[model samples]
Structures are given as C-alpha cells and as structure tokens.
Target: MKEKKWLRTVLSFASECRMKMILSVICAMISVAGGIVPYIGVYQVIILFLDGKPMTNGIVFRASILFWAFICLAGYITKLVFYAISTMLAHFSAYSILENMRNRMADRLMKAPLGTVLDQPVGKLKSVIVDRVETIELPLAHLIPEGISNLLLPIGVFAYLMFIDWRMALAAVVTVPVSAVMMAFGMRTFNKKYAEYMESSNYVNSVIVEYVEGIEVIKAFNQSTTSYEKFQKAIASFKDYTLHWFRSTWKLMNFNGAVLPSTLLGTMPMGMVLYINGSLSVAELTMCLILSLGIVAPLTSFTVFVNDVKAIEYAVKDADDFLNLKELENQSEQITLHRFDIEFDNVSFSYDADKADSPNYKENSALCDVNLKLSQGTFAALVGPSGSGKSTVARLIARFWDVGRGKIKIGGVNIKKLPLAQLADMVSFVTQDNFLFNCSLMENIRLGNPKASDEEVIKAAKAACCDEFIRNLDNGYNTTAGEAGGKLSGGEKQRIAIARAILKNAPIVILDEATAFTDPENEDKLQKSIASLTKGKTLLVIAHRLSTIKNADRIIVMEKGRIAKTGTHKELLKGCSLYKDMWEAHIGAKQWAAGSEKGAVKQYA
Candidate 1:
C-alpha cells in the first residue's frame, strides 16, 4: 500500500490526457509484439528447413530465405514506426499533465493566505514547483506507457516459454528472483535519501536567491566577502551530500542492472542439458532459447524505472501537501458593504509561527484586547514605537490574517463574511515596501483599477505628484517599471504606489509609513495629494513622524500591544506622557537632520 501511494498520484493526473495515454499504451503494446514476431519467425524458419531428418534442394531453400527475410524486414519496420508514434504520444500527454498540474499548484498558492504562503521558504516552494514537479516527466512521459506495456509483454512471453518446456521456463527466470532481492535493497530507504537530497538542494537554492536579492545590502555593509563565503559553503555542502547519496546506492543499482538481463546464462545451459537428456527436441530447445533472449530486453528497460517510483512518489506527496495548505476564511458570495467604518472588537492577535509568512513576525502577541473604530470619512492616525501593534491593527482590518480572538468588521458585518475579492476591491493598502510588476508605469497604476483608461491613469499620476518626473523620462507613462519597479528611486516608487491607490479610489485606505521614502521637497506635494484623496473616505495612517499626523481628526497612541490613549493630536500632546515624549523625540530628529544639511552646505561653500 505504501508503495502504491506515488503511483496513485501519477494516475490521478491521467484523467487530464486519458485518451492520448491510452493510445500511447496501445502503440507500445503493438511495438512489443512487433519485436517478438521476427524472433518467432526465425525460429520457425530454422525448424522447417534445418530439422535433422529432412533435406531440401538449393532452389527451394533460396526461395525460403527470401520469404523469411521479407517477413523479418516487415516486422522490424512496424516496430520502429509504432514505437516512434508511441513515444510522440507519450511526450504530448506527459507535457499536458505537467502543465495542468503546475497551473493547479499555482492557483492553490494564490488562493492560500499570505501567511500560509510565507510560512515556507521561497527555495523549498520553488524546488517543489520547478524541480520536483519536473521529475514526474520521467514516469509520465517514459515510464507509464512503455513501462506497463513492456512489463505485461514479458509476462505473456514467459507464459509461452512455460507451455514450451516447464523446466527450461524455470531456468529462464532464475535471474529474476535475484534481481528482485537487489531491487528491494536499493529501494528500502530510497524515500528517506531522496528527501535529504531535496532538502540540501532547497537550502542551496534559498541561499543563492537570498544572496542575489540582498546584494544591495551586502555591498552597502561591506559584507560581500562574508555573504559570498556563506553562499559557496551552502553550495559545497549540497554537492557533498548529493555525491554521498549516489555513492551509497551505487553497488545495489549496479547489481540489479547486471543480473536482471542475463536470462540467457541460465537458459542456454539448461536447454543443452535438456537436449542431451532427450526430453527436448532441436525445435523445442531452439524456441525456448529464442524466447528467453527476447524476454530479457523488455525486462532490462523496465528495471530502469522500478526504484525511481520511490522518488516520484515522494515528489507527488509533497506537491499534494502544498496544494492543501490552509487558507484564510472568506465567503464565496459577494455581499454589499453599506458602510465603510473600520471596527476592531476586543481583538487579541499573535503571529503564529506555524502559520506565519513573514520572517520578521513571531509568536509574540501582536495585539491585546484592542478595541477601536474609525467612522466613515474619518482621518485616523496611529502613533507608536516599533512593534507597538500599529501595523498589526491596520493589517487585521484589511484581513491580512484573521484576529486570533475577536471580530474585525467593516460596515457592521464581520470581515470573514465578505468574499475575498469583494473585500480586496474595497481596500487600498500602501506601505513603505510597495511592489510593482515589470510593466509600463501606466499599467502599474492601472493595476489598482484594471478597467481605468489611459486618461484616468495619467490623472492619478498627476494627483500623486509623479507626473512631471514621468514626462521628463524618455517613455513617460509608457516606460517599464523594471523588476519590482527597480528602475525608480525610493521616492519615485512611493509616488507611484500612491498613484495606484488614487486610481483604485477604494473607500478605505491604510497607509503604513507611506511617506518614509519621499524627499522633503516632494513630501508636501505627496501630502496634498493624499489629503485631497482622503476627503470623504476612511483613512488610517501608521506614522513614525508625529508632525505628519498632527492635524488628523483622531490620533490613537499605542504602547506595547494595547492602546495608550485616543484623542486629537493637541489633546494627546497635552494629556499623554508617552505621546509628549514621542513628539519631543520627533522634533529633535528633524532638527538634527536640518543641522547636518546646513553643515554640508557650509563645507561645500
């Protein structure tokens, strides 16, 4: 039953290209039968013409030779043609199965919660998606039709050898039991060894990806050598483990290969013994030898994939586990949100390690008995120190992850009742680290409202105060964003992210350090754009700089994982000690930055 698990996974995908696979199997069978016809025809020709008691003239023998030659030629051609067709069909079905399986996995990952997707390393997920999935092509493309047909054909041939002479039949298969034992030893621990190999490969892949992605930081800190050393060491470790894995199985695999295809060793000698004992005639012994030789070829091909089943099985199970990952609860049907007020009711939350996607997050309690509400059209600002639960509050309202305990509702309805798409359509989240696909600036902005026209995209860009710089570029709005919007500077990326939010025009917006990257010169313009856009919508700002949110309708001060106070900024400054201290710190940082700028100007002069 354990051995059948991987095969079941492969066959489960067979429904995708069942008809093609069936045809491939049929062609494979015909190919096998075509192979045997020539050997049988030779046996017949020798039996009829060279029987010890008979003699035929040269004219008749010449005619017989020509007939047999033509028959053998025809049988050989059929084998080649059918085998070609069978392989072509197998490849088509195999690729189709692979494509369908990949798409399904991708869809599953997308539907899975952000935290669930983040729980696994990028390298392991990619290893499963790209490398592990590719391994299935071995069984699907080469092994299924060919393996099954070859296996079945040998059984039928062996049965015929049994009918010919039972003792010769026993001799012919003596190698099979020995081969089976070798196969058992080879496969006994294959699943565990293969898993270790994959883990090392995944670790190497993750290190490579991390090294490349963090190259900017690595150089900035002058840790290039250290980073490169780490990457090389990971790669070296993976190589050593792979070589060790192969070395461990080297002997058993060789034994199986060498012994499995030597049926003639037993049959040839046994047939000679039988002939001497007079229990078998020349015709009977000749047929047994011919059949034994024929049987070994297909058996040899079949052994190549016997142990490989272990690896493919493990791959299929891993993929199945990923596809079954937990997802955030969401309704299937869309429900209208009559109001846009954001409400968190006694929400206590923690980032569970088992379900966390972000490396920076932990099992630490993020929010403790938090209760807050932002009315429709209210401008709310959250002020807190690092890890004070400001961002977690905003994220829960946006349903990044469901609160561990308590209800987060938007418009008087629990967020879990809202369909994922409908909820997504209603919220626009802009953060310090915003993502932009590799496409034109126009398209990137249009992503917020995919149906927005060219004119609308430009209007949003102008509103975000990025229009002037965009027009100064060679392609204006048509220029590509590059990978993750890498072509743009930090300030430029922020403006584009703001432009996207403006284009979306969602009723509720959460801005977590949205102005962190903008230059002082453009900060005012960016604020004006945000102020204009938030005129009648609920706005939540998670700000580090207290001055930016001083004019907000409501300011909520956070300490640890709970709210310290809530009031207008002026009231909080007057009444709250922590808020006042934070304000003083913010002022000093600004003055320090101004003094540094002035010192630089004096030095230049």
Candidate 2:
C-alpha cells in the first residue's frame, strides 16, 4: 500500500510533465530497439563470415560488406541520438517539477502560522528544503523513464534468447537469484539506516551552525575546549554512524556486484554443451554468447536503480510532510474595521498548539483566562518578570500564533478573520533580536515597506536616530549589514530595526524590548523619537526598564500568565505589591549602576 501511495505521489508530480515524460519513455524504448536490431545484424554478419551462408532471411550482409557495416553504424548512431534526446527530456521535466514542488513548499510555509515555522529546528528545515528535495532528482530524472528502458532492454534481450533456446535463456539468468539475495541482504537495512544517517547529518549541521554563531561567546568565556569538543563530537558521531552504515552493507554489495553481471557464466558452458549435441548450431551458440554478454551492461544498469527507490521514497515523503503542514486558517482578507483598538477577550493560549490538537496533549498554557483592551491611540505598557507571558501577549496581538481559546479582535473584528498579509500591515513588531539581512542598510530598512523610496527610508532612519552613526560609516546607508548586522553594534541594529518599523508606519506598534540595547546616553532621545513616531497610534511597549514607561497611559502588570494589575505607573505602585516590588528593584539596579560609575570616575581621577 505504501509503495502504491509513493507511485501515486510520484505520478502526480510527473503529471505536470506528462507529455514530455511519455515522449521521453517512447524515445528510450526506440533507443533500446535500435540497439537490439544492430545486435541481430552483427549476428547475421558473424554467420555469414563462418557458415558461408546468409543467416538472416535476406541476402543482407552477403550482398555488400560496406552496406552491412553502414547499417550497423546507423543503428548505433540512432541509439545514441534517441538516448541523448530521452535523457534531455527526462532531466528537463524532472528539474522543472522539482522547482515547482519547492515553490509550493515555500507557499505552504508562508501560509502557515509563525509558530509552526519557529517550532521546527533550522537544520531540519534546511535539510528538507535543500538536501532532501535534491534527492528526488535522481529517481525523477534517471530512474523513472530511463530506468524503465534499462529494465526493458535486458528483458528484450532475454526474450530474444528465449525464442532462440529456452535452455540457453535459463542459463543466462541462472545467477540472478543469488545476486538478488545478495542485493536484498545489502538493502534490507537501508531504509532505517538512511533515516538515521539523515538525522545525524541534520544534527551535525545544526551543531556547526550553533558553534559558528556562538564563537564570540565561546572565546569570551574561555570555554573553547568544552564548546569545541561538543562541536567535534557532533561531527564525529555523524561520521562514525555513516561509516558503520556503509561498512555493514559493503560486503554483500560487493558480492552482488560480482555476481550480477556474470550473465555469461551459465550461457557459455550451456551453449557449448548444446553445440556438442545436435541441438545447437555454431552460429546460434555464438549468437547466444554474444547476446548474453550484451545484457550484462543493461542488467547492471537496471539493478543500480533498485537502491534509489528507497531514497526517492524517503525524499518524497519528507518533502510531502513539510508541504502538508497545516496552514493557519483565516476567514477572509476583506475584514471590516472601524478602529485599530487591540482587544483580548477572555483569551488563552499555548505555544505547543500544534501538538495540543492531539488527545494525548498536556495542558501547558502560556496564558489563561486573561483579558485586556488597548483603546485606539493609547500608549500602554506591558511589564512582567521573565516568562510571565508579556512577549506572548504582544505576539498574540501580532497574530504570530492563534489563541487556543477566546478571540483577539482588532477594530471590532476577530484578528483570525484577517489574512496574514493584512494582519502584518496592521501591526509593526520590533524586537530586540530582530534579524537583519546581509544587504545594504537602505535595502534592509526598506524590507519593512518594500516600495518605500530612498528618501523616505532616510527620513525614517533619521527619525529613529540611526542617521548620525549611519552617515559616519564608510558607505552610509549603502553599507551592508554583513551577516545579521555583524558590521554594526547591538544598539545600531536596534535603531535600524526601529527605523524599519517607523518606515512601515503601521497603526498598531508593539515594541517588544526594542530599546533594550540603547545606551543611557541615547535612550531618552530614542524613546522620544519612538513616542513621536507612535503618536495617535495604539502603542504597546514591553520593557524591563520601568522608568521609560512611567508616563504611559496604562501599565499592565502580568504575573504567571494572568493580569495581576492595570493602571498608571503610580497607581500600580500604590495598589499592586508585585508592581511595587518590581519598581523598587528597577530603582535599586539603576542606583547600583550610578554608584559603580561614580566609583570608577573617582578611581580614574
């Protein structure tokens, strides 16, 4: 049943190039026929040379040597030409279909929720997209149409031999069962082994990436020995597993290889015996030997594709798994909106919503029975300890993940009713660890609003206080971010991210630790700029520094995934013990920094 399903899936991909694949198969069959016809001519020519009589039904070779040679040469040329045409057609169609599958996978990801993409590891996803997808090319390009012909050409030769003598034909294929047993032994463990191999490869890739990304921290902490050992261990594990997997199958494979092409082993002796008897002629025995040798190459070629069948099945199944990930459902793109107020109506959520659909899913709620509202054009602040669901609240507002229960409305309509693109346009989320592409600063900022002009990008950058440092750089706005903004300081990346959000100018701006990297020197200016940019817009700023949001119209205190308090900063301090303790801690930390700075100044003086 699984084999049948795999064929259906492969045929579905082939249906896109059905005509091309059909033509290619036809050409391959013709190529094989062309090869067989020349073998017949060669056989007749041999008989003419030895028996002094025409072995063919006509006076073909006896008439002229040059004509027979020309016929053989033409036959070989036709075989070569049609084989080349078939290969070209097969490869062209295969790659085209592969490209389409990749595009469809990309589309599926775009339609999926952000949480769906985030939950998967970077290495695993990369493996599926780049490595696993490429594996399909082997079977699609070579094994489908060409492999069919490879199988048929040998079968055709065997049929002709059977017509000549059933005993010789049986002898020709006598070693097949032994070779088959060897092949089966070698490949019996391939599926499970290959899956493990892929898993190890993906782990190595992920470990390498992690090592490279954290190299600076590794050096700074002087933990090079341990970290490098971890890195080496991952690679070593993958290498050891791969070598063992290969070693386990290598001996049987060698035996199979030794036996598979030995078609002449039985045919030669059997034909000689038959010739000794009155049953076989010298010409017929010679023809049988020659034709049996001819099938060795085809038989070898056909068996080569047997291993590929498993690889193709695994590759196609992995690709299909990624492409079939459940998409986030939305009602329509044309959701009606009157205002941009954000509302959480008895909302609850969990990060593992993907697994939560299962009956065995445990309840690990990130937020539960929490309800809040941000009126239009209000400046609200979300404050909490680490993992208190502050970021989750902001993420929910941006529709990064759907609420497991209850409704989140934007402008009186459920946010789930808005398509991803429309929802993205409504919210501008700027986080501390926002990604920067390896491109010019102008282009990076313009990613927020792709159609934004150069001048507008500069304006937004200036507004976000990125213009001064940007201008001092060698290329100014033209400077490349250099691999996740490695060329700039953390503060600079933050400012650029804010500039992107500013350029977007969405009505709902959620700054999730957007100012975490800003130094004390520029924090006030950046805050002012942010305040100015978000004027008359619904602003939800999540911050650890309470001083920055002291003047916010509302300060929401979250504790253990529930709203503990909501008021102005002073009201919170007066009424909420948790808020009061957090404010006191913030002040103490600030005073400690001030004291340390003063002590350093005195020591320097």
TM-score, per-candidate, Cα-based: 0.87, 0.88
What TM-score does structure 2 among the candidates reach?
0.88
lDDT of 2 by residue, 376-420 (tens): 988889999998999999999988788888899999888888877
Error of 2 at 299 (Å): 2.1
- Residue pairs with colliding backbones in model 2 are none
State the C-alpha lDDT per candidate: 0.81, 0.82
Error of 2 at 430 (Å): 0.9
- In model 1, what lDDT does residue 182 have? 81
Best by lDDT: 2
lDDT of 1: 0.81
Which ten-residue region of model 2 has the weakest summed lDDT? 596-605
